[model samples]
Target: MHQERLTKLRNASPAVLPSLLQCDFGDLRSEVERLQAAGIRALHLDVMDGHFVPNLTYGMPIVAGLRKLTDLPLDVHLMISDPAAYVDDFAAAGADMLTFHIEAVPEPAQLIQQIHSHGIVAGVALNPQTPMEALSGCLDQVDAVLVMSVNAGFGGQAFDPEAVQRLQQLRQSHPELLLEVDGGIKPETIGPCHQAGCDLFVVGSAIFGQDDYAAAVRQLRDAL
Candidate 1:
């Protein structure tokens, strides 16, 4: 199941995954419909525990709700301290790809295998300041690597220039890895990241903040 989802994601490479964090929850179904109608390949959902990132976001309920809403792949990001504890819950909640922070887990290999056992794509994420070497042990084991261009706690933060360099290094070293960039991805900043070899972009405010979602997505695609 994970292999099939990974193939779908690869086919949609250089795609923008609109973050649900910036969407209007009251009209979530409509927001998702608009994005799908606009041709988004996937959705990015951030699950944050208050302790891990100093901010609390939605969990399984939201993921389960989204599963019923669209067939688009749900790229669930676990910004929590103990992602190992909830892998089963998120998998059952309908996450197609589960990405966890490397800083949060002491032994990522076990967690990666644990996630795969549930038949969902597993990914490792690196914060802005975390060096590439930190992922040396398990880089080849996961399906994707999410490069957080800003701090993980919040949305609408500025894109860190250092992330581009990190993307370049990863692209050069691990040519086949699925490289995703999150945070501050807008029309202007997205171009550079794409050039730097980012395959998937996690965009929040740039898509949802606009009145017309299609035009906003078009602008970002054009910028790419």
Candidate 2:
């Protein structure tokens, strides 16, 4: 697919991405359909293993189940110990974008190439302590960079506003990279990240836990 396809897929103002995360598997189809109607073009799936992030989330069964939900693109974050071990599994599970922690595998660039070989976009994530300098040479190899502004194991944590400056420096160093901020994103916090050059912002509890999901999505979109 063309790179521009991502920009054209959603109707949100400012052309920013609002990726829904920590979603209820029971109501996924309806939730996805509602997001589609609400002008969302992508969903962020947080995958974790007990060792990597102190939490165990979903695997093949749930990922496969979600593949049936919608046509909107899926952004799969692998918070596992050995992400490279399951690259093809995630591709087979229908992930449009496969993201893994930069600290996971021995070779970040090669695994990214492996994902792209599967014909899916590849992404690398940075934990609260992982520096962008670690991604130095491979910056061009990954399609996106996910910066976890809050610790990964929990939700509803406060946004680390300092991430805005940290991400800005990284964005300045690699302007073409697709920057995504995951964790504690609300209408108030996202604008600062946007100004700091984040292209996509991931929000979980702020959207799904709200009484009105679509309205929340719209508010985030408008705020961006």
Task: Please list all clashing residue pairs in model 2, or write none if there are none.
Answer: none
Model 1: lDDT to the true structure: 0.92
Write model 1 residue lDDT over 109-213, tens digit each, in one string: 899999999889889999998877899988889989999999999755778999999999999999989999998889989999999999999998889889998
Each prediction's number of clashing residue pairs: 0, 0
Question: Which 10 consecutive residues of model 2 have the lowest summed lDDT?
Answer: 5-14
How accurate locally, in lDDT, is each candidate?
0.92, 0.75
Poorest stretch of ten by lDDT in candidate 1: 154-163
Winning candidate number (TM-score): 1
Model 1, residue 25: distance off in Å is 1.0
Task: Predict model 2's lDDT versus the native.
Answer: 0.75
